[model samples]
Target: MGLNVPTVSTGKKYTIEDYLKLDDGQSYELIEGELILVPRPRTKHQKIANRFFANLDRFVLMNNLGEVNGDVDVYLEEEVVAPDVFFVAKERLTIVGEMNIQGAPDLVVEVLSPSTARYDRKKKSRLYFRNGVKEYWLADPDQQLVEVLVAGEKEWKWIGVFDREDILTSNLLPGLEINLGEIFR
Candidate 1:
C-alpha cells in the first residue's frame, strides 16, 4: 500500500475547483492549495474499510446518532476529503448540496492505509480541525487502535485512544460505546 507523494509542480497555483476537474486517472485531494493523489490501497485495506463501515453503520443505527457511508465527498471550501466512513447527524443533513457536502461531518473516520498514513495523521487531521469537524477518528489497522479527536477552542485535541479490547465513547453520542476488539477482527 505504499504510495508516492503527489508531486505539485512548482509555481503553479490551483484552486479547489481546479483539483476537482483533474481527470488524470488518479484520485486527487485538494488541501490548503496542495494536490495529493493517494493511490488505491491493497485488498487488505479495502477489507478493513468495509469491516469498519459495517460496525460503524451498526453502531450509528442502533444509537440513532447519524448515517455513515463510503464514497461521499466532503467539501470544506478549500478541499474535499472522502473518509473511509463518514457520518453526519440526521438533523444536520440539510448541509449537503447538489455538488458536495457544504461542510465537514459530525464524525469522520478514516482507516489507515500505508500509502495515506502520513497525510491521514498529520495533514488531514489539521484540515478537519480547521473546518469545524466535531469529532475525528483515525483507525490504525497496523496498530489496532483508534485515536479520537475532538474540537477545541483553537484546534482539534486528541481526547482518547481506544486500543484492542478497549471501548470507544464519544460525547457526540452519549451512552454509545464500541469495542475495539470486534473491529480489529
Candidate 2:
C-alpha cells in the first residue's frame, strides 16, 4: 500500500494536537511533521508482535520492573508514533499520560511488516534513539530472527541478532530472557 497523505491539512507539519484531531479510523505516525498512514499488520506480523508482547509483559510484571503496552501511541519530541510493543521503566512511568505516552519508552519493539520495515529500521529507530529510548528490537517474521539495538553516544548501536534457536537478552532489562523459538512459534 502507498503512503496516504492526510486530507486534514495541506503542506503543514502535523503535531500531536493535529494527530489527535484526526478522527479517521486509521493508524498513523507523525514523522518529522508528516502524517504517514500505517497499514494494518498481517497475521504473521500480529502473531509475532503478540508473542513478543506477552513474553515481555509477563517478565516485566513478574519482576515489578515496569509497565508493558502494545499498539499504543507514544509521543516523541514533536512526533507521535505507535510502537508495536513498548516498555516504560518503573521510574519513568510519569511519561505514561492518560491520552498517550508523553515521551519515549525505555524499550520499543517493532514487528517488521512489508509496509513499514524501512521506516521502522531507519527513521523510527533514529527518532527513538534521539528521544532517549534505551533499546530497540526489530522482530522479522520472514527472517525468523530478532535484531537488538541499543542507544549509543551518537546513534543506535547493534547489540546482537538472535535466530530461532537462540535466546535473547537485554542489558536494559537485566534479568529478562526470551527464547526466539517460542517467539517465532
Candidate 3:
C-alpha cells in the first residue's frame, strides 16, 4: 500500500503558520501564500550540494565569517524557503534562530535539478532577491556549471558563470574561492 500523504485544501491560501502545522515527511516551501512541494534530489544533485556545503562551511569557519547551513528552513517576510545551501554572515547571525532562519541569508545556493530548475532560476531567485539575500548561486550538475548573481537595486545582477575547470569566487565572501572541478566531481 502507498503511504497516506497529507493534503491541504484546494483554493486555500496558506501562511507560514499553516505551513508549520504540516507533519508530513516531505519537504515543502511556502511562496506567495502557496505551498510548493520540493522533490527529493538525486544522487548527483546531493553530491554537488554536499561539496558546496563542505567548502563553504570550512571557509566560513576558518575565517570566522559566519555560519553555513544546508537544507534549513528560512523564514522570510511571508515565505518560508529551504535553500540547498546557505550562509549567514557574522553581522546577521541573530537571524539564525533556534528553529529556522528568521530572515534572509547572506548567500543562498540552490543545486539545480530537472524537476525544479525553472522555479529555482526564476521565481525563487526573485523571491530571494526581494527578501534581501545578497548573493545567489545556481549549481547545475548536468551542465557542470555554476552561475552567480548579486542582488541589484531592482533585481539580481549576473556576476558570472563558472565551468568545470574554473574557480568560483564570491563577492560577498572575499578571498573565498572554490574549485569547480571539485564541486562537480
The best candidate by lDDT is 3
Candidate 3 has which clashing residue pairs, if any?
Answer: none
lDDT of 1 by residue, 93-169 (tens): 88766666778888888888777877888888888888878999988899998889999999888798889889888
Give one digit per residue, the lDDT tens place, for model 2 in 9-112.
47887787888888889888898988888888899999999998999999999999989998888988789889999999999999998878999999999999
Residue 164 error for model 3, in Å?
Answer: 0.6
Stretches of candidate 1 off by over 4 Å are: 1-4, 97-99
**Model 1 steric clash pairs:** none
Q: What is the lDDT of residue 71 in candidate 1?
A: 57
Q: How many angstroms is residue 107 displaced in model 3 relative to the true structure, after the best TM-score fit? A: 0.4
Angstrom error of the Cα, residue 151, model 3: value is 0.9
Give the number of the best model, judged by TM-score: 3
Model 3: how far residue 81 lies from native, Å: 0.5
How does candidate 2 score on lDDT? 0.88
**Candidate 3 lDDT over residue span 1-185, tens digit each:** 32122224388899888888999898998888878888788998999999999999999999999999989899999899899999999988999988899999999999998778887887788899999999999999999999999999998899899999999999899999999998987
TM-score of every prediction relative to native: 0.87, 0.93, 0.94
Clash tally for model 2 = 0
Models ranked on lDDT: 3, 2, 1
Show how many residue pairs clash in every candidate, following the order shown.
0, 0, 0
